[model samples]
Structure formats: C-alpha cells, structure tokens
Target: MSDLSRTPLYDLHVELGAKMVPFAGYEMPVQYKLGVMKEHLHTRDKAGLFDVSHMGQVIVTGTDYAAAAAALETLIPVNIAGLGENRQRYGLFTTPEGGISDDLMLTNRGDHVFLVVNAACKEADIAHLKTLEPAVTVTPITDRALIALQGPASEEVLAALDPKAADMAFMDVATLTLDGAECWVSRSGYTGEDGYEISVPEAAAEALARKLLAHDAVEPIGLGARDSLRLEAGLCLYGHDIDTETTPAEAALSWAIQTVRRIGGAREGGFPGDETILAQLETGAGKTRVGLRPEGRAPMREGVPLFAAEEGGDPIGQITSGGFGPSVEGPVAMGYLPTELTAEGTTVFGELRGRRVPVTVTALPFVPARFKRKPAKVQQA
Candidate 1:
C-alpha cells in the first residue's frame, strides 16, 4: 500500500474482509471472504456491488455540440455527431496503424459529452484527448467515485433508493439523488445483467456503498467476480482482448462504429485509423476474434497457441481471454483465427500443459445479456 493508490472506499473494503491486490496501480479488492465463485453466483442470482472508482470519468465540453462531437470523433470511429441526448455509445481509440489504443464509453448529455475510460489507460487517454486543445476542454472528474450495482435485483435495490432509476433503459443516463447523494446513474454495466453505474462525490461514496450493502439483495463484490462476469458476457478487458496491436476488425468490435462513421455514411470516416480500419471493414482482416469452447472441463488460459484442424500447419492465433464460466458450468475462452476457420463449429486445438486440448469455434456471450431496453413509445392518434 506504500505506493499503490486506493479508492475512497478502501477502508470499508478492509472492514469487510476484502483481499486487496495491486491492479492498474491501485490497491483494489480482488475478492471478499465469500470467494470469487460464490460472488459470481451471487451477482447472477441477486445483486453485487462493485467499486469502480479507478476508472476515469471526464466531461468534454465546447462552445457548441458539433465542435465537441467532432473533436471527440477525430480520435474514435463512433458517430458522435449523431448520438442522442442521454444516450450512451461505445467506441474505440484507434492508432494510426488501425490497432486499438483503448476502448471507452461515450454519453451525449446535450451540453457536454461524458467519457468513461479504462483505469489503466486513463492517463494516456487524457493526454491524447488534450491534443484537441482549445477546440474542446477535457476536464477529469477526480472528485467522484464510481460504483456498479449489477444483477436481476439491481433495479429493485436502486429503485428503492431513487424510483426514477427504474424508468431508465439500457444505456440511459440521468442525474438522480440516491440516499441524499447527487449521482450520475447509468443503466449500463460490464456484467450481462440489468444494472446501474452510479458516480457520486468521493465523500459520499462510502455512505452510499454502506446503504446499498445493507439492503438484503446487495452484496459486496470484488475485481475477481467482475472479471469472470464480463468474460462470460463476451466483453473485452482492455489490454487483454484489445491492445495497441489489435484493430477493431480483428477484435470483433466493428459494430461499435456506427453507420454514420462507416464508408459512404454521412460522417464518412475521419478517425485516426480510418484508412486501415475501413479497408479491413471492406476486405476483412487476416485473423478474427472468436469464442472457443473446450471439449472438456479444462480451462484454456490466455497465451495458449491455437492450431488448425490439420496435424501440421502454422498456428493461426492464441487465446486472449479464458476462464471458467460459472453459469455455463464449463470452460470458455476467446481467441482470434483466420476468416475461413471462424465459422461456428470449426474445430481447433490448443496446447495446454503439453497436451492438445480440442475446442470448437462458438458464438460469444456464453451467458445471455438481460439489459432493460425501454419500450418504444406509441404515437399519439
């Protein structure tokens, strides 16, 4: 703890018997006394509270909406200009070579754009955004602490705190007062469950956490369960599933680029890696990210090289993310492979502990997502 930074709730975590570990230069809780497996199950069954203050939250503002959107669009491939008020969109920061610099969430708040970037890449992200300079102002919200409440019961627990939270749909964001704290609540989470991410003032974070934890449906969760939950949902884990060398096309995240940002669309593509990314979009990439399901219960850990069906041939790719899915009740993993071998049911093998373990190309989101999308409003007669 000498050099590692800690969140506002660090002392509360210690009081709860949290096992702290070094992650992204912060002393974060990886698991509680209940262990990772149980915490994973609890999140699926009830609700789990997570301290995500290590993530970066910033407000990007300018004199006008177009200027702010265009400034941000220059770095990412998303259609920032077309994002509706209070709507959230996912985008990737691409390098000039078309590789990913980082992944982020962008929310259009009418007057300004709100960004949430991965903790490990936050500093670099800020520096990169600062290149916009006088065109747009990038202000980091250091006084806030972010928390994620996820699971089926998350809505109920949050609704009890602020009934307005129940009206929000997936990716919807609003300013709400929860337990007397003015928080920025979003109906979005890394887990594939219905939930909310609340950003509150640092001083109010502990009291808010304690209030939620006291609820019968909520339990404290750590980074361990958070990783497993996101993995099961097929979500990328920044440095692992994506990195400076992996482009959006290779990472199976092309959908993050809206139609307006694609070739021949309104905005057309003026992003960092538009040329390379657009070319890959049209011609397809050499290796595509895919889900892998092992034939046995053996977990196919990351860095395990994957081989094609034929006995003797060059290795196509390697597993980027792998772990046992508590919901799937088996081993699940993801890796990249050639376009021809990306078809579902394509057989592939991985060398684990000096043995060739068989696996098959499978679709992602081993567990189904339960996001709450608002029903379409009926037109008045």
Candidate 2:
C-alpha cells in the first residue's frame, strides 16, 4: 500500500471512515461505514457522492477541429468529426486486430476535445494519442479531481449549487462556476442513473464534496457499491468485461460505432482494425457478451466456466464480471457466450465449487436506467 497513489479525496475518505483498498494503482475507498449494501441502496433511493478522481481526464488540442477529429478518428471507430459542441459520445480504442485497447468517453469542447479513459489505461491511451500524425497535443489533467453525484436526486442537489445544471441534457458538458470554483461538469455517470460528473481543481474537491454531502439526500459512497450499481446497470468494467482481447462486436458494444464509420458512410474504415471490425459487423462475431441471472442464491463469479445443461457438455464461455445486485435482489453477471446461446431465456450453467449453478440468459441492465433526456419541443400555430 505504500507504493499506491492517493486521490485528492483520500483524507476525506479516511475522515468519513471509508475502508481503504488498492484499485487501479490508487488507494481508494471500497466502502464506507454504511457498507456496500446500504451505499448501493442510498444511491438508488436518493443521491450518492463518489470520488472518481483516479480516472483519467485528458484534453486533446490541435490547430483546428477538422485536424483533431480526423486524428482521433484514426484511433477509434466513432464519428468524432460529426460530434457537436458540448455533446459527448462513448467510444472504444481498438487494436489493429479489432480488439479493444480501452473504452472511453469523448466530448467536443469547442476549441478542443475532452477524453476520459479508465485509470489503468490512461498512460497508454495518452501515449497512443501522441503518436497520431497531425501533431495534436495530449494534455493530462492530473491536478483535477472528479466527483460523481449520482442517483435520481442528483439534479436536485446540483441544481441548488448551480441552477444552470438543471438545463443540461443527458451527455451534455459544461464549464461552470460552483461556489466560485471552476467546475467542468457533465450530465452523465456510470451508475445508470441521472447524475453529473464534476471535475474541479484538486484543492477545491474536498470543499465541494462536503457541500454536496451536506444535502439531506446525499451520502458518501465507495467503490464497493459503485461496482454493484454498474453491474446492475449492465455497464462494463474495463479489463474485466473488456480488454485487449475483446472486440466491440464480441463485447456487445457495436452500438458505439456510428453508421458514418461503417461501410456506407462518407468517412468509413480508417480506424485501427477497421477491416476486422467491419468484417465482424457484417458476418457476426463468434462469441458475444450477455447478461446472466443465477437461479439460486449462490453468486456466479469471474472465471467461472459456462456450459450448456447437457450431460458431458463442453464449456461454452466464461463469466467476466459477477456479483450480488442489491437493486435486483439477486446474483447478476455478464459474460461471453456463443452467439447461438446468446438469446434471452437461454439456459446456461456456471461451475462453482464443484457444482453447476443454473443460470438464465437475460437482457442487460438488471435495473432500469433513469437518464434524464431533453424533453421534446412543442410546436404551436
């Protein structure tokens, strides 16, 4: 633990009685005194504050939007050039073989592009960005702290601090002043809830977090509940659900690739592994990721071999992520399964402790998402 890095909120986490643990080379809080179950429930019922400063925040600068977008397009299969200002999109960095290097969120910040990648992949991601031909600048914002205020009541809490926060739609980004501190806020989160990710200077993080926590509906949460929330939400965790060996098609994230980057668009097939990815898109992948619900109380876990329920059957795939979902009130998991068995209601078994645990293939997101989208405009004569 001595070699582990600490976030800007480390002291506050300790002061709040957080159980410290090492994750992605950082000393993070896995749970507070409320424990994982209560924390998970609190976020669902109200709002929860999470210190996600360990994640990477980077800015990509170039001479112009066209050059920067094109340079970024060469790395990922997304329509970066088409993204409007202040709007964000989810994307994945792919290898030449079409496997995912890392999953990320990209936002067009008018003058430059803002990228947020997984903590463990930030270094390599930055290095990869620097290698692009257009001579764009990759600037890592290590002096910033990211806090996620997530849950159904997030808007209420944040709007009190900055009224303009309520005006933003889902996946919208803004630079605002919160209690006089510069804050780069985004109306998005990983918990499948309506929330905001607040990026502020490191020195002001604790104060801002305290102000948010002072809200009657807000509580400090930890990584333990964060994991369960994401699992219930069916969001993928980097390195576990996705890695260098998994492609977007195999990861069930083909939706992230827009049509413009596909076969019949104006700009198509210039990204890494475009050939392999395009082929997979056309012909279908061998194995695809699917959600699983264990029939019994036993929780299926990672590396558990999946098999068909027939006698002397060979393993089909393996579980990548699994856990007990507080919101779902059951054991939920996601893993790779053969395309033939990827349909909902399919039967599968996971080997656990020398016994076969029966599970059913189900649609992802055990819990329904509560994202706040912009209301449709009304027209009158």
lDDT of each: 0.92, 0.93
Model 1's alpha-carbon lDDT is 0.92
Report the C-alpha lDDT of model 1 over 1-381, residue by residue, as the tens digit: 689999999999999999999999999999999999999999999999999999999999999777899999999999898888998988899999999999999999989999999999999999999999899999999999999999999999999989999999999999999989999989999999999999999999999999999999899999999998998999999888899999999899989988888889888888898999998987899988998998888899889899885367767889999989998999999888888899999999998887778899999888999999989899999
Clashing pairs in 2: none
What are the per-residue Cα lDDT tens digits for candidate 2 across 38-119? Answer: 9999999999999999999999988987778888999989999999999999999999989999999999999899999999
Clashes of each: 0, 0
Can you give the lDDT of residue 3 in candidate 1?
Answer: 100
Cα-based lDDT at residue 70, candidate 2: 82
Please, what is the TM-score per model? 0.98, 0.98
- Cα error of candidate 2 at position 45, Å: 0.9
Give the worst 10-residue stretch by lDDT in candidate 1. Answer: 308-317
